[model samples]
Each structure stands twice: as C-alpha cells, then as structure tokens.
Target chain A: MSATVDVAVIGATGAVGEALVQVLEERDFPLKTLHLLGVDEAVGHSVTFRGKNLRVRAADEFDFANVQVAFFVDEADVTRECLEAVRRGGCAVIDLSAGLPAGQAPIVVADVNPQVMASLKAPYWVSSPAAVSVALSCVLAAIAGQVEVTRASVTACLAVSSRDRQGVTELARQTAELLNARAMEPRLFDRQIAFNLLAQVEEPDNSGHGALERRIGNELKTLLTRPQLKVAVTCIQAPVFFGDSLNVSLQTEAAVDIPAVCAALDASPAIEYVEPGDYPTAVGDAVGQDVIYVGRVRGGIEDEREVNLWITSDNVRKGTAVNAVQLAELLIKDHLSKILT
Target chain B: MSATVDVAVIGATGAVGEALVQVLEERDFPLKTLHLLGVDEAVGHSVTFRGKNLRVRAADEFDFANVQVAFFVDEADVTRECLEAVRRGGCAVIDLSAGLPAGQAPIVVADVNPQVMASLKAPYWVSSPAAVSVALSCVLAAIAGQVEVTRASVTACLAVSSRDRQGVTELARQTAELLNARAMEPRLFDRQIAFNLLAQVEEPDNSGHGALERRIGNELKTLLTRPQLKVAVTCIQAPVFFGDSLNVSLQTEAAVDIPAVCAALDASPAIEYVEPGDYPTAVGDAVGQDVIYVGRVRGGIEDEREVNLWITSDNVRKGTAVNAVQLAELLIKDHLSKILT
Candidate 1:
C-alpha cells in the first residue's frame, strides 16, 4: 500500500460533495492528488481544499483511470452512468448517492459493518446508505450486544438539504416571503415546506412507502445482516436545513436495560449520547458535528421490551461525507494494495 | 333537556380558547348565554360569538353557577384552583387543561368513547385529552374495528402553536431573524424552534418521557379502553404554525389487512382518508379542517402484523375545539336534563 492515494470526488458542488471535500481536509486524509468533478451547472464551480481553489471539471469528461479511488456523490442516475467507466478504470468506488444496488455493491457503515469490506476484491465497489440509515445503524449497532431487536419503527424528520441546494434556497425564499406578508410559492417541493412537515419526502409506491423510506429499511437490514428484522420507516420532510432527526422505537426479545443502552451509546465513538434529562436537537447540537447526537433514550410506557430513542445527526457531514471517508480509510488501511494492483 | 343551556368558556383568549369560541359559534350550539372568562392578562379581551363581541371577564371572579357547562381551557394550575367552585356550582365541567387526573375526571374522546358517558352522573367532570391524543385516537379507534392493535408507537410532529400563541410568535420571530442574517434569540422554546425539529416538547422526567408524551400514552390507553396495550409516544416540536402531524405504527394481533384498514379509515366520519401515491401535509390540507387527514397507510416492510400511517390534524380546531364541541353535543343529546337540574 502506498503512503497516499490519488482520489477523485464526483458531483463536487452539491451539499454532500462540498462536505466530502471539507471532511477529507479536516481529517487530513492521506491523498497524493484530489480531482473535483461535476456535471452540467456544477462544473466550473470552485471549492476550497487545503487553501487552494480547485475548480470542478465536467464529470462526463474526467478520466476515472487517473485516480486510485473515486467517491460518487452525484445523484443515482449519474452514478449509474459512470459505474462501468469506473470499473473499467479499475478504481475503487465508494457511493454516497445510493446509485448501486446492495446486491452489486454491499451497503457498509464503517463502524457498523466494516466486516463486509473483507469479502470484496479488486475494483472494490461499496455503497454508503442514506443519512437516516447511517444515523440509525450507528446507534442500533452499538446496542446489538445488549438486545436482539425484532422490530424497529422510525419517523425520520429530514432537512430540506436532502433535496439539494435548491431546497435550501427555496426554504429561505419561501420563509422570507411569508414573513414579509407576501404569498408563498413553493418551488423545490410540491407544497410549502417553510414551516410545515411534509408527510412524505417523495411520492410513494403502491404500498405507500416512498423510495427513500424503502432504501433506509433495506440498508439497515443489510448493514445489520438481519433480513428477518421488521423495519417500518416513514420519512417526512422537515423545514430544517441541515440535520436529520429521527424518532425510533424498537421491540426487542428481552426487556431493554436503559442504563445498559446508554452505556453502549456512550461508548460508541460514532455517537455522542446526551443524558436522559437533556435531549439533542438537529439545529442546536448536530448541525456541524462529526458524531450523531443521541438522546431522549428510554423504555416504553407500558412494555418493558420496547425501547425508544431520539437521534439527531448532521445530514451532510457525519451521515454522508464523514462516513464515506471512514470507509475509504478502512479500504486504504487494509485493502489498498489489492486495489492498487 | 331544555331548549337552550348557558355555556362558559374559561381562558377564552388563548389559541385553544379562541378556537373553542369559534367552534361553538360555527356549530350553533343551543346556548342560552355565552360567557367568556380569562385570567390576568386575558381579561379585557373580547371574543366574537354569533356576530356579537363577548367581553372576557376575570375567571377568578366569574360565577360558575351561572352556566350549566364550563369549558376549562386554562393551564392546569388555574384549572385546579377553579375546580372546587365549579363542582360546588354543580356546573358540568369539560376540562381541556388536562388539569384533573384521570381518576378525578375520566379522559373522553367523543367519537372514540361515547359509551363512557353512560357511566357518569350529574355535575359531570369529563376531560378532553391532549390534541395529539385526540388526533391519534380518532384514527386508531377507526382501525380498531379492523384489527386488534396490541401496540402502537407514535412520533408526533407538533406545531409551534401547541405552546400557544406565544410559540407561534417566537417561531415567526426566529425565522425572520435568521432569514435577514440576524442572530436568533430563542424565547418561548428552550432553543430555536424555527426551521428545526425539537426532540422533546417539554422537559422530560427521569424515565426520559416528557409530560406531553406521557399524557398522550395514558390518554390513548384510556380512550381505547385497552389497559394492557403498549403505547410509545414521542412529541417533537416542529416549525409549523398550525396543524400537528403524526407518524404512527401499530402492531396488531393478526396480520394487518390493507384493504380493510383503508376502508375503515375511509368510512370514519371524523377522518379524511387520502389515497395511496398521494398524501397530506400539515400545511397542505389540515390547518383549519374539521376532520383529521389520514394517509400513507401501509403495512411494515417485513412484518405482516404491522400497520403504518401518517396523520395530519388541526391541533386547535379538530383536536381540541371540535372534539370538545362534539362531546358537549353528546352530553346535551343524552344527559342534558341530568346536568340542567
């Protein structure tokens, strides 16, 4: 394995993409060279990395063979389009766009399912799950030692940034208009998301489950390797701009020990466990942090076997970018030689 | 029963109180006289009823003996202070403050538990549950006809108005401040409530459940008449000005029949069912509506015995005022003579 590897970041101008570059710099990731690539309007935007202005080039024109590993931060359609090229270039791929199916590239959370990486060969392709799934799996995987979860239900309050920068712009515009006593014309979302909760983040299938909701459920199961676990997910679009907050309820085989669960969360490096009396909010505690903020941890009202949790996470940083980087770190630490060969 | 009955609305200056007066006027209740009463700051205000402005008097000095029924909408402390006088006045009490314990005044939702009225005597002291409870019970009770729900978990995304008119003002203030590039100074809520999801609406207890969350759980159990049912409640403060949205997951004894569940929700007069592929939001459909909007109904991804639903309801109108009026109508229809004596 080399001391440093050349890396390319696709979709370098979006929220997650911008954060990916920032996280790589913040963590001082070992990189010999960094290539910023984007598509359409994203191309030519300048992002600051290591005190240098790196201009994003067209992702369509960039040669994937130049980099040892590539982080795909674009939307699923774009990621799907470039998959073959990346494979042909023999570059390892870490997907944050949820483009590749789990069957083709296993969904791996660095802290939760790093073991999955050991089974991969050259031209390694790994997928990072959605932000909600990443936040949930971090805490749930920490507590797997204490309880065997049979069923889990999550109500994820997603930020507008999940829709990209346009979402952030629209929320600010809608809010300003509404505040100044002007009419609100919702743009990015179907309706006004300024100060309201949209029941579904996207249109659902016939079964009444939205695409993101299904993706979250599938990712959690794969990350936990619990195909039989019953996961019910409802993803609502919140007016928030930065972080995602989730209300999770789990049914376990045995009674949940509250203290034990707290201890487990407290010990996890990926989570910051707030005490029972104090809770964490997305804006107040988790907007820019590197770790998921977990609080409001307790048992059920009537059933001892039930456990409820409130988790707040930085949607872009820790949930997506930082996680992808951690996976990259693991690959560089153990599988770098195989990929470089 | 007489042709008309004198009614009094205590704490008639706040959000719920204001909605209560409007509902009474909209419903055209058989009221011989309408009295609007309030506490210190609420006095001197006027509420319009039947096209006439009604002055708000001091609740401390008002005579409960003058009205056959009184709707207590003040805080629990005020409700407690005035309870003795009301009982002595032989006035039928419909408490909305949640001031009285369940043992002292049984919590009742008109549609969910009309039969509980038969168990009451004169000088009725019936309690209206919290807005979240009313909204949830309406939908859950409707589904109880189709499935035997053994457990229910809910994530209630409450609007800012749940804290009263002041909460609404603070969110608007915070949002405007943030939009104009000014610093946010959170007042009503512990932290910024604008464009954020607050994990706990109120301070939680040692067990990590907030007062409102616990109240919702207990109220659901009582309203459903299922003492052994497991209920998990998490009330989050959302940025919305009005309308509360809840993501509810229920576990029934048998596999949930999707068609039957949809039919039951559709048939319920108190609920407005939204078909699959389309959904409702707090601002889009339920701000001032009288019926609770139910949508996103589906089964769990892996568990057949689970059912998930998204519900949006006017916390002030349908949840509190309308439900209270419906209870008043029920009392008038069957037990009016007993109270008028």
Candidate 2:
C-alpha cells in the first residue's frame, strides 16, 4: 500500500523532535509526505525520512491547512506558537511540549487511556505526559485498578537528552573539559552536569519544586485520572547521557500481595517486567528500550501497604518523541475509522 | 601543653585515610607523635603536618603497643587484621572500615550518638555507619525522638570517592576514555562508574539487596536505636567525583506538622536546615561541607502522614573521615577527662 496521510513535524532539530522523525520512520507509519518544520535558520537543513531527504521549512512560513497531523516537540514557547497555527487550520495537534491548548486538553499516555481518548472531539488538542510520569503512570495504571493507591513518591534521575540537543551537547562538552582539567561553565543547566547530580531543574518555581518535579506530580494525577492522589516527586539530573531511572514507592489503601502486583505489571502492555534473578540498569538494559523497564519489585520491609519499584526507560525513544508519535497513530486510527464508515 | 597523644592513621594512602589526616590537623588535635601507616610500599611516603613532613610506616609492622589511638580507614579486611593487633596492645581503635571487630562494636556517628558512646568500655571497637546511613540517621534521630518514625525510604546518589583513592582514579580514567570515544572497562566497580548509574553495588547478596543497600538499612536501624525501624535504602553509584545526595521519605506513626519537623531539624546541631527560597545541590553546596545540608522539606501531598526531605553532604568529610575523627574527639572528652581529673 502507498502512503495515505501527510503529517508535519514541528521543531525538527530538537532531541525529541529528531527522535520523532526516527520513530515515525522506524514504526513504518503511513506517510504520504513528511513535512519537517523548525526555526528560520534550520529551514534549509535536511532530515532523511524513508530514504528521502526532506528539507526543513520555517514553522511560521508553512501553512498547516491540509496537514492531517502536526507533532509539536519544541519548547513551550515555540510550541505555543505552533499550537495557534495548527488549531486555526483545524489540524490535529499532538503536543509533546509543555504548551498545550490551555483549557481541558487531555494529557495522554496512549496505552494507558485509549478508550477515554477516542471519545474526544475532532481537531483534538492532545498533551502527552512527561517521560517520568509516563513511565510511572503506566506501571501504576496496572495497579490503580487492582488496588487503591493512596500516595506515591518518586525520585527520578533524568538523562541529559531531556534538555534537548543543547542538553546532550553540553554534557558531552563539559564532561570532556572537566576530564582534561579545564574549567567548564554551566550554560544549559544551572550548575555542573559533567559528572555531578543536579538537585533541581533549570528553574525553581516558588514551592522549592523545580520544573521537572512539578510536572511529574501534575501529570501523574492527570494520567491516572486521580487528581487527589498525593505524589512526592523529586527530579534530579543524573550524569548519564541517556536513559532515565525512577525510584518509586507507592502506598496502597490496603495491604497488597507482592505476587499479584507483579502479575499485574507483567500484564501491562506499556511496561516490560523484569522477573527475579534478573535486574535492569539503564546503560545495560534500558538504552533504546521502548517500554518502561521495571525490576526490583517488592513490598516495604515494615509496611506491606507500600510497594517499591525501580524503573528505567530510554528517555528519548519512549519518553517524549515516541509517545507523541504513538498518540498520533491513535488519533489517526480513531478518526479514520469514523470517516471511512 | 605540648603534644601529649600518640595516634596512628591506618590506610593513610586512601581517600578517607588521607581525609582523616587532614581533619586531625585542621582540628588542632594535640599530638606527640603522628604515625601514618598503610602497606609496606606506602611506608616511606610522607604527608605534611604543621609544616613537618611525617613519613608513613608499614601498618602491620608498626608497634601498636605505645599508640594511644588508632584510626582504621582502609577496607574491611585490612582493618580487620589491624583491629586484632591493636586490641592486644590496649590501643583505642576508631574504625571507619567495615572490618572493625564486627561482633559487638558500637557504630557511632559522632554528633548523633555521643551520650550512648560515652558509657562504652575501654578499648572500644567503635564502627561508623556508611555516609548515606549517617546522613539519613542524623535527621531521623531528630524526628524519631519527636515523632514516631515507622519507616524511612531513601534513594542516595553516591560519589566515586566513597570507594577510595582507586575509585576516584578509576572514574577519572573511565570518564576520559568515554569522552574521547575510547572503550572503557569496569575494574574497581561492578560496572561503568564514569557517567552511568550502577543498579547495585559490586556484590549482590542473595536477598537481591546490594552491599551498600544492605549496609544503609542496617546502619540506620542501629543509629536510630530502633532495632525494628523499617528502612528502605537504594544506593546508586553516580558518575560524580564527590558529594552525595539522598531523597528520603518518612512515614510517621501519626500525622505531623511540617513546621514542627523543621523546627526539630533546625534544633539538631548536626543538620543545617535550608529555609524557604534556598535549596541544596551536591556539587555547588555540599562538596566539602561538614553538615548534612537539608532542604526541600515538605509534607506529602494527599497523605499528610509522610514527610519528604532532600539532603546532600560531603561523602568523604562528613561521611567517613570527619565522623571517625569526631569519634576520637568524643573518646578524648569522655575518657581523658577521667584520667586528667
């Protein structure tokens, strides 16, 4: 079969933006023509998609009139600009950036809540949860149905890619400089990222909760459809160049059986459960992985009411880009089924 | 009052061993003769103290008969051998190594447990807890006395210096190779420690808990004096060269006020509480600090019974060497007062 639909990739040069292009091609999504859009300077740069070199177009200059879907994978400000144009042209928007169309947009993780998402109206403005939240909510969605989770506490170690291309470049550059005994200046991040763990994100809003910390908590509630579930989220910048790891503790309403919880996690489509005798590490097992690789599953020593889990996932592929692409697939399938009938 | 005490620093060439020498000099501890001892090869190597170059002697061959105090800072095995010889000679052993006469040793964290330690016997074989446990317990000791702490969950990012001189050197070597796009192998650790987070410690005991993980829990329980306090500890080896950060959550027996807990923490001399508007990071705030830098204190959302704390400290100074030295200071105040009087 030939290509059937046309989609535009906004913010084509970002870490997640670049990953979106790859995920689309790797998943073999039905593409009539892939439109690559970015800033004015990147307009002439080319990205290879399906053996064809597609020249990037400035997002402001391009018309989104007939675009079937537009994936906005840039920073919040740039995404806000793209969202306005995409919405005006009645194009379906899959947002990976923090900027979603302000009001009542459903933050999504495709596998976690597909049925609820399918019921949304056309030209839907969809927001995807952050990487840490997606990985966490996927595992929780499996158990939230089986048991009532009263609270969750997560300490996440994010990869360098979360800052986009600049993040990855800065880590590589600063790391080399430090090893050579040269002084490194912090630019992309607030402090040194060469071989240090940053306790906070780039910006710390009032409550002492950094940007990444706040997002994880908010998104957890949104994805799990539980607005009141207490979540304590601490996002630290790990020195690793790829893969994110989260140490999560969940307190259920009642005592939970360890064996039953493991069985539920194994059944979840979005998570790959690591059985006993085998543990998962990001560099060894989770790099380039498509699922939330979960292991070290057990109950708390004194409190069986609590469940502890160590989860690792590829921050780029499964974190933002791939999830945006997955949501687009769901958007197409659900919308296409209606038009065809 | 010229120098009046004879002290020997075992494992003088290692990280903690080296730091122990520095702490002793900085504190202006009265010394008659400072004997630095390690293996045979390290014996002729000199370290400067108060403008004098003191040469190291072989630890095994050095006579412990006249040594008033000996600090064992090497690996458990080396310290184990030294403990036996030192005990026979009636020398007071302040052990930082795992080896220190394991059976009935009282593990001390100088500031946290001086009262309990003052009553111990002569020639006390006192062991210090790991850095992670020491930091966690310092804060918990404050809260546990005020509020009943049923459980504590900690996720600590450990520095390379926690291992020793070899660990610090290995990380530097590995980081350079990776940045230069060269192949690197794991030697001192079980896996890569340059820019990666290891899933567990070098050795994994049957319960699936790594060496560091098991030690943190055992030490926390011992320090808190609650033999049954349920502590969940996850120790991840970070790529950084110094400083350690821990994300700790405490489940109190009852709902507690956040401000009251902060007041208790502030009252604790060992902890420096960062009030609102300011936070702590490993590299920027904690690298060479003495106190357990605590900030980001908040109540758990939805679950009011849980308390969250973010703590960072110098792994070598506050974690091991400094704590060991403080124990010696305690020993002098407790025992020397009796002799002097």
Candidate 3:
C-alpha cells in the first residue's frame, strides 16, 4: 500500500476526466505516474497534472502494461475497445461509461456499496449513475432506510457541464454573448441552452424509460440493496453550468413523518440539509460541493404514503469524479489494492 | 337581456382588473357604461374601454346604485368593505378576491359550475378560485371525475404577475434594467425573480396550509362537486411573467388510463391537451389563452392508484377574468340577469 500505483485515465480532457484529475490531486492519491488518453485528435497535447505536463496519448498507443488501474471515462464504444487490452495488461478497469459488464455487479456509489468492490477477482468495471440519480439516491437513502421505495419521480434540472467541456464553454459563451447584445448559435444542446430548459435525453425505449433512467434504476437497485425498486425519472437540461437538482417525490411503504425524516437527514454525513426557509437553492451554491443539499421536505396527504423533497449536488464531483476516486480509496483502505492492481 | 347594463369594476388598474376589461370587450358583454373603481391613489386615472375613455373613480365615491353588476377585484378586506355597499345598491357582486361570501356559494369557472351562479338572487355574491387553483381543478375534474381524490401534491411554478401590477412592472423593469447594464431594485417580490424560482408564499396556517392552498382546496371542492377531498400544495414563484405551471400528482380511488384521461381532457372545452412530444410550454405560449394546457400524462407506479400531469394556464385569464366573464355570460343565458338588475 505504501508504493504508488500507475493510473491510466481514458477520456482525459473531458469534464469528468478533468475533475477526476483534480480530485486525485485533492485527495493526494498515491500515484507513481498518470497516463492520459483521449481521441486521436487530442494525441500529443498535454494536460497538466500535479504541476507536471502529461502528454495525451491515443487509446491505440496507450501502454497499459505497467498501469495498475485504468479509469475508463471515454464513450461506451471507446471503453469497450480498451477494456480487454487494459484487463489483459493486468490493470484494474473502472469504467464510467454507461456500458455494463454482463452478469457483473457495477458498483454505483462507493460509500453506498463498498462491499461490492471487495468481491471482484480481477480488473473489473464499475458504472456510475447519472448525476441527478446519484444526487437523489444519496439524499433518499439517508431518510427512508429499509422502507420499500415503491416509486421515485424526479424532475432533473441538469447543467450544461453534464454534456462535457465544450458544452460548458458553449453555455458560458452563449449566455455571455446574449448578455453582451450578441446572437448565439447553439451547437452543444438540441435547443438553446442560454436561458431555457430542455427535457430531451438519450431517447426512451417503447416503455418510456431512457438509457439514463434504466442506468439510474439499475444502479439504485445495486446501491440500495433493493433490486426491485421502481423508479420513474424525467430528465431536463437547465440553463445552469454546473450542479443539478432533482425534485423528488417518493412513495414508500410506510408513512413517514416530515420532522423525523429531516432529523435523520440532518444526522447523515452525506447530506447537508438546506434550510427550507432559505427560499431557493441556486446552482452557484451547489457548484463544487461534495455533500448533497436536501430541502423542502413535506408530507403528502392523509392516508397516502408519500413525501416530497428537493436535492441538489455538483454532478462532476459527487456524481462522477469524486465518487470514482472515493471508490478507489475505499479499495485501498480495505486492503483490496492487491486484487485491484 | 339585450339592454345596456351598468358595470362597475373594482380593483381597476390592477393586473386582473385590466384583463377583466379586455375580456369583457373581447366577448362583447352588454355594457352601456363602464365604471372603474380603485383606491384613492388610482382614482382619476382613465382606462380606455370599447374605444372610449372611462375614468377610474374612488371605490368609496363610485355610485354603485345604478350599476347592474359590480365586480370586486380588490383585496379581501376591500372586497368585504364594498360588498355591503354594492349589495345595498341592488347590484349583483362578483368578487374575484380571496374573500369567500359568508353564505353564498362561490362559482369557479362558470362553464364548470354555472348553476352556482344561476341560483344567485339579488345582491348575491359569486367568487372565483385563484388562478393556479382553477387550473388544477380544471385538470383534475377532467381526469378523476367524481372519484374520491385521496390526495393532491402540487408544486406551483407561479409568475411574479400573480402578486399585482407592481410585480408585473418590477419583473419587466428589472429584466430591462439587467439587459441595459443597470442595477435592478426589486420591491414587489422578495427576491430577484429574474431567472430564478422562489417558494415563498403566504405563510401556512396552523394546519400547514397557506391561503393559496386553502383557497385551491375549497375551490376544487366546490367545482369538482366533492367537498371532502384532501389537498396538499406547495406554491412556488418562477421567473415567468404571466402563466403558472403546476406539477400535480393525485391519488384516486380508481385507476385511469393515459389515453382515456387525454380523451377526457380533450372532451373538455376549457382544456387544451398539449401532446407529450411538445413540452416546455413557456409563459409566452400561454399568456392570453383561455384554455388550460395539460400534458405529460403518465402512470404512477405498479400498484398505486395515482397519476401525474403538467398543468399550465394564463393566471389572469382562465384563472380569473375570463372565468368571471364566462360566469356572467352563463347568468345571461340562464335568464338570471332579471333577478339582479
């Protein structure tokens, strides 16, 4: 455990990838060296890590022979291409793309399901839930423990940063341009991400469940230890740059008292209860935050087993990068580094 | 019925009052002369009606003696003040303020409850539901019918204009000032209200229901012909200027199909079904419309007797003015005008 480990970060230079680098530095992960890989167009370019410039390598040219862990943040197809190579090279793979390993458990949040990583015998992949879903699961688990979650309906107010670095730049550029009396051409999103909210996502199947929804449902089941919990989600892109908010209404098996739920939430370390009287929680307050902010807890109605709450978090950190790094930290702490490496 | 009727509009110069005059003109109500009444500050201001300028008079000095129908658009206290005077003047009073008539039945959306107005005699008072509440009732009636509404959880995306004319002007002035590189001093709303939504409303009573919530509950009871239904509402203010959108989830005794509910909604003349494919119905599209837009109809869960839908409408029109005028039209059609005038 004292020896530093070689890490390969695929999809380096992307939003989540950049955040992963920052998180690795922030947490002071024992890194002997870091290998950055991106598309062929980004090859030979450099990304600064820990005050040193690391040249971006094409996925085809990446030397995974000595890499201990390969963090796959690339697209699903690209991750699929490099999965076998990294695994064959004896590097543990942590895949962040939507692709799931068949018949394998893709651990969701490291804090929620740390034991799931203990059973992995080789370089295995883990799937992170969507930003909103991660934020919601963190919030909901703190309140209604052991309760049957019959339904979960969320209105996701997503940020432009969820799209990637270029999307973040385009959102800021378009918003500033509009503010400076100039016209904007939207390219990152299907609609104008300047001052509007769009509700389209990776298309839903015939059952009206999109890829994000299915991922969230499967991930929540794995994380919460409930495999049959039903989840209905509506994801919408908001005009925010970072952080996403979910307006969640849960139908539990038993009636929940609002005060008791708030007390339980306040006691949880993963949640920071934003005072409901504060009026509204803005994206500015949520940016770069580790703790998910929970507010607006209220009872539903007489004889109805439902409660509503609003949860917000920084998608890049708690939703993706920090979560992945945290899982790696847990693995090291639990003496599973030998297996992972 | 063809004869000219003297009409007195209290709360003139206000948002709903302005829309009331426009609705009357648009519907060609049989008004020989129009008298506008407001507080002392708004007195002497002239508003044009039917291509003619009509001076606004003080509510205290306005001669309600000759007016056939007096519309009270002022606050609840002011409406209570002039209710006796208007009644003593032998005119039928239609109160739009939240003040419910002591013993008279309040009519909500004349098309839905025309008989409530038809039963009115001389000096009888009729009241309409709040804008958001009416929108909710309209949607619920079409979907649930006479089924016992076990519970209703509402999240209102209200507009600043719901407060008064000052709110309307403040939002516009602040938006323009922000666009013009000037600081915005918002007085009507508690917060910025430019690009954010706030959940600040009149504080809830001992039973945890605010004025808007209580009014919505009572109004729905009257309109849906169910007096025992329970409702839980959370009203929030959004950046929109005119329309209010509500995310409503209701539990009923019977199950409802999505298409059947859509058909029921389409069958109702007062509602317009915005298809699921066409969403994000902004305030601009719903400004002057008289119909409530209902869409996003989906099932709740596996065994839950509930459904969710998005409801939006022009607060000034379908929620208030147009509904009042429609009630008056119903009175004329029912030959009840002779009972008052």
TM per candidate, chain B: 0.97, 0.94, 0.92
Backbone clashes, each candidate: 0, 0, 0
Best model number under DockQ:
1
Best by lDDT: 1
Encode model 2's per-residue lDDT on B187-290: one tens digit a residue: 88877777678655555554446767777888888777888788777777788788898988888889978888889889988888988556787888887778
Kindly list the per-residue Cα lDDT of model 3 for residues A188-208, writing each as its tens digit. Answer: 675555544454454545433
List runs of model 2 lying over 4 Å from the truth: A1-3, A142-148, A254-256, A263-269, A275-278, B1-3, B40-44, B101-103, B142-148, B253-256, B259-268
Worst 10 residues of 2 chain B by lDDT: B199-208
Q: How accurate is candidate 1 locally (lDDT)?
A: 0.89
Q: Write the per-residue lDDT of candidate 3 for residues B195-245, one digit (tens) a residue.
A: 444444665454344567666767677787877676656676555567776
Q: State the DockQ, from 0 to 1, for candidate 2.
A: 0.54
* Candidate 2 or 1, higher DockQ: 1
- TM-scores of chain A, one for each prediction: 0.97, 0.95, 0.92
Q: Which candidate is the best by TM-score?
A: 1
> By DockQ thresholds, what CAPRI class is model 3?
acceptable
lDDT of 2 at A272: 88
Candidate lDDT scores, in order, read 0.89, 0.80, 0.71
Clashing pairs in 1: none
Residue B293's lDDT in candidate 2:
87
In model 3, which regions exceed 4 Å deviation? A1-3, A40-48, A51-55, A101-105, A145-149, A165-204, A301-304, A339-341, B1-3, B101-107, B145-150, B165-195, B200-209, B227-230, B301-306, B339-341
Deviation in Å, model 2, residue B285 alpha carbon? 2.4
lDDT of 3 at A173: 71
